[model samples]
Target: MWRSKARQWLLRIPTPKCSPLQYQVPPGTLIASRMPSNRPLPTFTCLQNPRLLSASPSFNSRDLDDSDVGIVGNAVNADDSRESEASPVNLDGEMDESGSFGEKGQVLQEFGDSSLGFDDDKVMSEAADVDSLSSLWEESVSADDSSGVFGSQEASDGVVDEIHEVDDEQVESVLSLLQSTLVEPLEASLNKMELSLSEDFAVRVIETPSISGENLVGFFKWAWRNCRSVRTARVVELLVLAVSDVPELGKREGYMLWDLVKEIGAEKGIVKTEILNQLISMFWKMGKAKAGLEVFDKFADFGCVPNSDSYYYTIEALGKRSMFDTAWTVCEKMISSGRLPDREKIGRIIAFFCKGKKGKEAHSMYSAAKEKEICPQRSWLDSLVCSLTKNDETVSLAFELLDDYAKGSLKYANKSFADVVKGLCRIGDVKEAKKLVLRMVESGPPPGNAVFNFVITALSKGGEMEDAIALMKVMEGRGLRPDVYTYTVVMSGYAKGGMMDEACKIFSEARKRHSKLSPATYHVLTRGYCKMEEFEKATDCLKEMKKDGVQPNTDEYNKMIQSLCLKALDWRTAEQLLEETKESGVPLKGITRSLIAAVKELEVEIQSAENNIEA
Candidate 1:
């Protein structure tokens, strides 16, 4: 190891004899010979054999090359000498005129009367072993790469490294200031750090941990003001993220930070779409929907074209506050621009419009996103369809959406299709309602009892008994039992037709299937029998309802009593029903009770008139 290090050390030294010999170096004479530079400079010293300098003046300069000279790597300025030492060059050992060297000092003593000097302690220790000297040499160079104080190249490198360390420390200082300084007037704090600002420095400060968004905003404004170059595109983006990243940032603070971003963008002309988008997203997270909208509106001012995220976040913000009108407007813009957010975000937009009852606009967004191949998830589509089916005008749109999403088992679609069927039925589009039921039965998501009941009820109300029965059969074929409401609808249709037999057939089937039927079935028959003036059958229905454990509603009693009073004028039986109705705790209508009283009075008047005539 010692041999290898000694060789490496020997190779590092250059000229030894020509070294400007200084017997005594001043306090800092070894600092630098020339301006510090990066070029590899060989160090020179006169510490080697001092006897080499004793060559006579008559010796040719070329002869000095043949003579032995030691190696030291550096150039020493000859003119920098302070004290000259006695000549240590021994001519007998060196050379004379024949074997002589002229210009023994070469360039070092080029001007006449210049002296070579060596004064350092290391020189006097020339008698020291190569190993000891080698150790000392290593200690000095290893101690500091630039400590070869007379070596300008190493000094230059040292200066560069020092500069980098200082820069790093200043950046840390700025970051410390950023985290602690919350209020305004950040420039003073930054100035105290004496930061040598750069994009990297600004980025480091912005990225510092535990830094509040407010402090970051302050720091950002400072950077923009004091060092505009630090606000590069990357720096600005990081600034936005740093400002937006704080979870506790309130709406007011969020707006202030956003305003700072805007001001910087406006003046610096460095506004970017993503930068603005970060602010919008921050507002969205903060629930500051209005502020997000303002940022969205100024997209043009920032020289940024709104992207898909821009629209999505803006719509989401507005929707958060139930600002559907403005949200829809932005959604329309997104549609017109043909830029839709990702599938998930598109789903959220649909939900927003749905929440606002803007089902039509929601559908439009859904369709446009579909056109762009950005369809929302199935659940979202289902929600959109549900919303569409709510309004009479948009039921078909919901119906259309149903077909697109009806791909899988259609089981998930059952709820949505149920709503669509209801809307279809409510709008009196009984034909379409029937088709939807059949479609469900044939394709997928076989209609449940509710969907079937809706269509059946609509058909029965339209007096289409056959269609209503047909739907009930289809429903049974699918193994879904018709609820009591379903059977009631079929019977009502038949009773309306005065086909008592058919109505009774449906009633019996409902009784067998349901163990207990709704009172609506009995009412249907009572109405039908009364229409035929067969009060006996109507009274039997009342008896059957009581036997069957289905409580009769007031409507049946009202109709039966009115039939006896008005149609049959048989107020005697009607009075019995009134007493029965009263005993049963059912409140009879005032008009029906009055009719019975009127009938009683008429009977008395008739008797008196007849008696008077006979007398």
Candidate 2:
């Protein structure tokens, strides 16, 4: 009966209503219940037993009165509620708070009233339960809101994704702005950033074709000022590509590019010899020969000794621009540096002298090259021949050079043989020129149109018309069609021979063959007309000269004035010619001034004759 009563009391506790569950036990009852009882005296203790009280909901409260029980109960409930609020527990027994509850609950209970008489162990156990219950309640409340359902890990991941998206959009916007701003100032700013940033950024600036040349140059200048680490090779490549875009920049700022490359190479340390060579080459291509020399001077700073190829480029650049003195200095520098000049480079040095019309210097260089077993090639030999011929020197040097080739003492390729022949013809040495031509036909590759034209011109200028005509036959026999020069030479020969009819026939035949007449040919024909006293025909030649856009040289003007004064005997005509000569601004040398003075005297004579005839 007592067991049934204890059971009924437990059931009537109303299940704690999901509110704070506070268990309050009487103080003495806890000790009495815990004391091992041997006697079975009480009916409740015997039937259900205080041992069952160990399992009973309120067994420790049995020793206390109702008021003490109520007080303990209220205090316990209040403590439970406070702990629950501190850390709500999930239904699955997980805490929903920040896991800082145990310490907080200990502090709170320690500062509270001692009337409750809460045991330290009991208080700690109750605090732990309260924490668990609080966690459950928090979880339930959080579940109702969708945003709060996210775990810390998932929330952190979402924040990172948003950040990445924002960064990507910002990058895209910047790229778009770069594309749209085609102006030089803005593009230059972009290029500056690229140079400062990474290689990918630099490459983007390089690959963007929308950037104009002015902007690209400005960018390079900025880079040179700011980016001290840029490689010389990269700057050269960028400038080279940029040159094709802005030809004007090439004219104005090309030297600046060269200077910047030199600066970068000097500052960054020359890690690549090829890059140094390229930088030197770019200076030449940009027509900055002095800049190329400056680059050469910087080579020593990088610990690179000047090589033959280095001297070759520098000398060749100077030579091309007619800077013979500078070119010779470079050649001497190369030799003094203990680097033997390569045969090809030596050939270029010789060609430079030839190109500059310095025949004496060229011959010296050729002899030096030969002494070193560095045989001048055919092209070099040809240049030498042309140089000597233009200077109108005694052909003995050229003959000696050719003889060396003929004796097989110097390496003579077929082209070298042809070069000697062309050289003889260039100097108007008709007999020697013809001899060389016959030798070429006998031993070398059969003479082509170029060789034939040279020989024909030599014979024509030497007043050997028949010989020139015979050579034209030989040319046709060799299956070589005479070009315009051949025809011009033959006609000029006839004109010099005073065989006007034959020259006219040849000129007509040449026209029939559709050969384009050159300015020299017209000048020759005009002289021929003056020689025949055909002053009207000479005037027609002058009109043709104008039509062909050929400016009359001093000789042509002298011939025209002489013919007009002698044939027309008109004072006004002679004065008009003199005035035209003065207006043309051609330099009047000894022969030209004499012609002008003669024409004035003739005009005075004509005026005297008119006055005498009138008187």
Index of the highest-TM-score prediction: 1
CA lDDT scores, all candidates in order: 0.71, 0.57
Which RMSD does model 2 reach against the true structure?
25.5
- The digit string of per-residue lDDT tens for model 2 on 1-615 reads 322222223212212222332332211222111111232211111111122222223333234332321111112233333433444322222343654312211111211234334454554544433234335434443443423322233442444222211243433443454446554565454554432333333344555565555555555555446544434456446555654345344545556555555555555443345555655666776677887777777777766667767887887766657788887777777656655577776776777777777777778777766766776677776677656655556355766666555344333455545666676666656688787777767766467788778788888878888888898898888777777678878888888888878887887777667535666777778888888877777778777766657677777777677667666654455456667778888655565456656767877898899999999
In model 1, the Cα lDDT at residue 300 comes to: 89
Candidate 1 lDDT over 1-615, as tens digits, reads: 433343234333332454354432221112121222333222234434222222222333334342223222232334444222323222222433443223333222211111222333334344344455446556555544423322344333343223322377787677666667345477776776666776767777777768877677767777777876676778878877876777687666687777777777765457788888888899888888988999999988877899999998898888889999999899888889988878888888878788889889888887887788764688787788888888889998888777677475377778988898999999999899898888888886877889889999999889998888887888888888898888888888888878889889888888888877777778888888999999988888898889888777788888898998888888899999998888889998899899999998998999999999999
**CA lDDT of 71 in candidate 2?**
16
Q: Provide the TM-score for each candidate, comma-separated.
A: 0.68, 0.36
The backbone clash count of each candidate, in order, is: 24, 12
- lDDT over C-alpha atoms for residue 251 of model 1: 67
Q: What are the runs in model 1 whose C-alpha is more than 4 Å off?
A: 1-193, 589-595
- The C-alpha local distance difference test score for the whole of candidate 1 amounts to 0.71
